[model samples]
Target: MRYPLLMRFLFLTFLLLCASLHADESPDTIAPIRERAMEHQKAGRFAAAVDDFIKCIEEGSKTNRTGRRAEYFARIAYNQTRMGNFKDARENMEKAPRQNGWKDEDPFLMEMRAIVFLATDQIEPALQIAQKFKAVNPKKAEYFEMVAQFFGGDEKCLATPLGRFLFDPEQLLYNGAVARNPKDLIARRRRAAYFLERANQQRFPNSYPAKIPVDRGGWAHLFDPATAAGLPYSFYASAFYDLSRALEMCSSQDEPFLRVRRAGAAYGWNAVAPKNSLFISAATIAGDLKRAQKQGALDVRTQRALGDFFSETLPPVDQPNYRPRLRSGIQSYSRALYFTRDESSLRDPDWLETPETDSLQKVRAARSTLIGFHLSGKPVALPDLPPLTELAWKDYGNTLVAREELGSALEAYKKALEFDPEFVPALNNIGTVYSRLGAFDIALEWFDKAVKADPKFAIGWTNRAGVLDELGDVEKSLASYDTALGIEPQNAQTWVSRGILAMNSKSWASGQNAFAQAARLAPQNSRYAALSAFAKFANENAELPKIDLSIEDKTWLSNFFGSDSLAESYASKGAADKVFAAREWIK
Candidate 1:
């Protein structure tokens, strides 16, 4: 979670080592204080550490370590940099130890100074420092040249005039920094901050963009990189290259796909550019992300992120290739199901799923809408590519389920099983589809296979139990639920299911205990709360509490959703927010 720049990593690594580096003046007092401050900084609690470090610097005796004073100042500047205290970061960098021979030789000092100057209004100074450093250390010349070109101050850095006409210096600073460090994904994503800025700038050039917080390094402006404005076309092209390169370089740790949307690639120059090359480039990267998933190069979150990004960024609504784009997007979202992480604990709205939809079923619905539109005429044909991995086929099958193409969904699921015979999700889902078609006996066969394939999968066990319960095999269902519970004791939904099953069988004590566990595990779930309350009443021979809806809360919910019937239902459950949720509203 704490992925730092290489130098920042060094700064943190040294914090504890140099904790007691102060020369003897209350070294005992200073060491612990310094250690805690450094710990706070590592945890991203900058304000908490600032006061302690300041106290250490003021009260502790100066140590005789080489460049100790300079290092101390640099540490302060590093913290200041994170907090957007550019003024103090710059001051500290200036006070840092300089070499007797030449200051440019100090890479850390030069890098920090350039960073500070770039952030502030001193573009020229930053560019000059970068140029000197590039000369001092030619190996990092790319970074130096990028900074100089970013400010549009020195022609020597650029083979030709880059921004020959004009643009704000601040824009150049971020852009140049990214160009200088093309492989650094964080630097590359800084461009996303300019989304709104580029948008409004289209109609109002040479004017102000939105007022966004620069402290977070985002720009709320009205300038698009695609438009031939003060900056040349090459500038936008370079940015496109940077993003593509970053995507290629990205690993499982990043939500790089979603970052495309956050970066506003769709609305940035890529969306607005006269040439379709940028969009094409992005689409290519989208493919690369998929290939990465196939090769197991990406993490589950990245796949999910890409799936979300792919759906959201699909070549607008009117492109000729929209159908292929839709399928691709759906397939991407399906990747979320491939991971085995117990995501029931994830409470993010973006990750919400259903029995059929899982995380990406919503994207499948969008695909269906497009599919129906295509059926109005002869649909655009998609070029056939090589088959995807077993995981991708499973994803495609999920889309088929959403489209109500049940037979075709089965075929896709079968294909998934072909690639990886033991893939449990595909096996379980096949059983689910058969259950839908009233083939309970056949569905049970698939469920048996699923549990056999991956006995450890808690969901598979839970699904098998639910199916058995539906098919009038109560004894088998109860046993299956127990098996699932044994595997995943924290599964709140499983507890709730077991509670309901026990209640149906008149096992009052068992029902109450199960419901109580469910409520304890998921207190916010209205279903769990209602079931637990009911179970308690049944067990204790007590009356259920009457509903007490507040008039204010009811009215607010009614007005927000514009539907009294839905509001009343939610008001009963005390789940006002869920009243207008997509699944609920659709139902």
Candidate 2:
């Protein structure tokens, strides 16, 4: 579970060589101390290694050999970098000699300096040093360059303007690195991080457009490059793929970080395509976290990722075992908060220091989500969360609504409105809560405000239609449905709602067409198929199409119509009238 055997062997060999170099130049008293320091560094006891390394440096300074003393400085700096003491590492790295002549310790010295630069967000300097090894060691140079590029793409690596180039337009650098070495962990991780960041920046509904054209002949459209190019979720899918590859090559020390990234990408993909074969289930991600937990203690980032996965990515509240999942999520968030009690306590030695304030805000928000679910409209003391943006507050309100805490949800939505009066989602959700409370007139006003704020918001228009229907304004409701469908024609639920409205108004042909469109858009749903057939039967059509009934579909048909065979009977036009008379569609 440690680093690969060959890599460990090479690292130990390098350590031994460095220790043996100029052994007689330094006092024999320093040899055993330096060896112990190397052992401590390799064992991940960075604090102990730093202490031992300092002692060795103190002993080496008594000798007159400048090169050997400079090497000791570099050695201490490497340990300091591993301990997240980048400021001290940088100071020590500056004291190390940078002569043009190659020596046994030169490669280690250069690598330590580059690592210090990268740790301190100095990407350009890191790249410069990384390139120096190109002539002497091409593979090592490639590895360092890939590492430099990875840091260059980091959002926090702002010491140089080159950080803005997240990836090459075609990602040729990452691709070339992987091509040269298929097991290049840095290249794979960099690619994954790039896509994950891109996915984070994309807005919902716009990035996830409604009208994705489908070729009914087959699922070839799903695999089409053009189709993927238009969807933001494709970035998440790509990130998941790259992270999976990286995890295969990563050591156990690196596994938690990669697993957490992959889990995030998996959650995003599952949100968009839960029924796809490639969809990573919440259970699978939960298992991954469990395995990681069993490995040893987790860092703050890993714990936070685990908390988010449990709290937000689990199955819905109505599903079985949801209570257990919710409890687990709450515990995970609590643990995250426990670890993040202080900035210094959160040790993320693998990367630079993450903003402690930002970490706290996210952990607090996640805890609030679980707490809101637990309280469910009951008064309870909540965590003092940092101020959230309108979008964040609105999302929290949505989560409360999902938990069925209507009163608290309304309060949260109103809070979002205080931040941005014209926030459309908050307005629409407020309307939805009122509608659920049977306040149709108030819901209509809120819906109107939402659409007025953002006329392009199809969901707002759809809600307006539903409220109008509740108020018995049939003509206006139909008009609203038309407007909504025009904006987002591929929304199958909107079509279904519109079809129901048409059926109530006795517009048989319109209902039939709406239900048929819904069926075509979501062919996997047997309910849409049933609704379409019923609408056709109600229209007195001469030709009646049969409904495809799976075993579950047959059970549903039996429960709804008192006979499972009625769907099969509908295939023959002669029995269509009898099938229609079997159940009243006026519910």
Candidate 3:
């Protein structure tokens, strides 16, 4: 009955070979791998979950069973949709068998199909597919009903038991994931649309007594600011509320639904270029330029992409010294523009460009120190400006700013404001001029108005923070600066300013770290590099003062300052380095 030694060895070797082969097998070969992928999907780790789902789909497709293959394809399509891979999602959906019996009616398959359509902004088609589930799938009837109601506009459906569950934050978040966004330019924009759709049902509720749910709760609709506890009953109010929530959510730190949040929500803001920081979706910028380049160099799209690279900076700091990249990019843009004559505009009929204004060339010149044209022989002639319009005046102001003629710039800004009273850029520029002139209070006023004119104008916050710092409201200044960073964390100038504030506060190490960040963000900025070097030198030469530390200060330094062994070091050890390092941030 006992096995021979040779047979036992052969059996063990076969098992080892099988194990080795399994490592290279599709994800579904291991049940736990598939389960982990599902877990990743549920946790909104879409990018990571995508590969695992594809492996599972490959395993399923390898099977002879048509139903199993269809199910895998359908499931993977949902994951692909979440990953912003519209092409892959569509291909998977197409490959899945529509005629396979029962698999055709599978709720998950049907839901994914609707999801794909919805994600691409095909609402009517998605709603129709979702509607089929109402009678065909009883367990999912509530979910399908919720979808129909979102598109159908009926509050009565929401008052139903199923509606309560389906309209909850959990459900709306799933729908938000399916909203029309690929590069994540705006997650809150999608969430806003979700709430706006939900609120449409209640545009004019027919329940005469106005039977609002006493406490079944409005948590699901938190993203829908319209459903706030004490709002007046106007659809406009609700819609506007959602709109406000959308903008506010652009930088809110503590969004509860981080799991369902877009990738941008995590790392959306960071320095894209040297000595400049602005709120830019790098994905959108790259995507747009790629699309534009297909049209050729003469195309307005191509020129504009180059122009943005040349002239655009967050908050438009009057940085007289531009980096080499700016000059190179502007040189490229000017070369394209020079192809046409010193004629009327960027849109001369013979130039074969679109209807952009004549001011674009002038504005470009004003924005940079580069020669107005790449070819000196083909120099762009500056036309005399009697500014009748806001844009013309704005360009004139730009010219004045370039020349350091603050008085003339101020007048030009005034003219711009007179032409268009709500011009936010002029408002910001007025603040900039006043700040430059050391008129801090007036500058702050204009900055406030600029933000009021357009809260999403990140430059307003940055400019306002500078004014606040000048006025010596240190706490308020810090808060304002933080707000600006929240809005557009990529601004290297702002990081430099933040570092200066840290240095002023005598948090030497924190200031050093902040300066390092600024230097990393803008290595071309000589000022930031100098400040970083100084901070490092200061830290290296740290010397403890004779002043005794309070227990609270000691606790703070130990806990928050990453010097956890400070108390022990200062008391037991006479290490001069430890003493000095511990005192680096102390009062």
Candidate 4:
């Protein structure tokens, strides 16, 4: 899977032509050493290849192909790895700078160092280097997988962020640095991670709120054992994982809903500990009222209002089921209305006039807001919005974003922020829209605002890292990526993005490794597969497949993503040439 093999071959030919086009050095002077290194690398004499490439780099100093020099260093690092010189390879490859032109240094050399370290039972260093590489390019899937393997797979590592919850109350899921869980939590975690990954990948669809990652047994099913009992154990396992995440959120905040959820879980589990006990029904309301009173000033009124809202809103039950839930929802809503002036608008006559009127009015308002803000590129007014607790704005914002009416989406998001100035999603969506509009600086501002709002938001960190990479702020991008992976190591998209950035950095060896990771994380992604092949071929210095300008290639470029330039380029020179030439411009 090296650099779409066809693209690789064409790129090599292009590179060769570029070399010939420039009279900096005779082919004879450089070719012999390069060919020798290629031979050694091909025959598995990696050490020999390293030596030859090193010499070639020194000899090429008379020329100004810093890119070429970097490429050689990268390849040498790859060769050193086969010879088991992991430390040296890593040290040397780190010196390579990103190419100014199209040249990429050996993409997989650093990846190999980390890979081989793991193969040699060097877990700690492998993890560290792997994390470093991923931060530079988080899109590499294989690298992420390798890192996960070292930590006992996805589920085992979920415990890293919440050791107490994921590993059991006593943290007994692992023994002396190895996973002790036999239920295959690792694989389950990986599967569950995909739900989140896909949710993120869907790019906030244009109609419905982008799909939510709902796990029946995980967070989705944590409410009742009866619901979980209907599903397979695996379903429950994933649900538990989500529940753990939800609980983690609760532990970090004093959110009333989360607290209620905890009380519910405790009630469901019926654990004897006081912390594990829960109150439901009227008792739940009483508890909320008590908390409000303790905080002072109209807290009691707010709590009672919530109880009234719940009593009116809760659906009639044939039996006494879901009492706790009703109480929780009511209390939650009451707090929302009590906290902010903006949310008070939810009590507007348009909404309270009738249920149908409320629904339709809200939807129209959301649409108008999104259109006004994002499409029109107007500054959002933060005044006269709903309260943060109402969550009306979040709901409306998500609705508009789903419709692909980015302008409308922006407004809805802006309005949400007016309600909750510290809301993460509002900040995130605003940044996304700004990025779409090529307003990178403004996007960075919103993303920065999101990070400031909730430092624990992994998605914010990852997306911000992506913006930084796009802006060519490689060092800062790497730092942001580190923050993301540290928060959510299982995010495959982050791995892939990291990989792409690494490749673009002109450290060919590192790029190749990053691509490998991207491919592994998303095996079905054609881009990842193509890049993987390209990276491998580039490192080998072997002939790449000629780009076929055939109808098929044309269709792939034109019909698929409307890549007319790419199709034309491929038609004239080859697919590889077209891909390389169009890579930056296409996206």
lDDT of 2 by residue, 231-349 (tens): 54556766776676677668887787567667777777656652322345557666667665444233555665666667656677678876566656665555455445575444343
The residue pairs that clash in candidate 3, if any, are 169-220, 270-490, 277-490, 277-491
Over 1-587, each residue of candidate 1 has an lDDT whose tens digit, in order, gives: 45568779888878855664533333355667778887866554555666667766664444432323454566676666544355677676676655222244578666656655554435667667767776667755455445445444344444444433333445556566655564556655555334334443442455644453222112111112233343322233334434444555666445444344333343344554444223233454455454444443234455444544455555755787765655544444333433325554111223112233243444345434433442334322322647788898888889877876766777778888898898898999998876664334456788999999888888888888876765445688889999999999999989978877776666667888998999899987766665565555445532222232122322322343455765575567665454445224322
Q: Residue-wise lDDT of candidate 4 within 184-206, one digit each (tens)?
A: 33332333333233322232235
Which candidate's lDDT is highest? 2
Give me candidate 4's TM-score against the actual structure. Answer: 0.28
Give lDDT per model, in order. Answer: 0.55, 0.64, 0.52, 0.48
Q: What is the lDDT of candidate 1?
A: 0.55
Off by over 4 Å in 1: 1-184, 192-238, 244-271, 275-290, 296-298, 313-324, 337-587
Ten-residue stretch with the least lDDT total in model 4? 167-176
1 versus 2: better TM-score goes to? 2
Cα lDDT of model 3 by residue, 474-499, tens digit:
67777877788788878887877776
Q: Order of all candidates by lDDT, from best down to worst?
A: 2, 1, 3, 4
TM-score to native of every candidate shown: 0.30, 0.32, 0.32, 0.28
Candidate 2 at residue 48, lDDT?
Answer: 73
Q: On a 0 to 100 scale, what is the lDDT of residue 490 in model 4? A: 67
* Model 2: ten consecutive residues of lowest lDDT: 214-223
Candidate 3 steric clashes: 4
Q: After superposition, how far is residue 114 of candidate 2 from its true place, in Å?
A: 36
lDDT preference between candidates 2 and 4, better one: 2
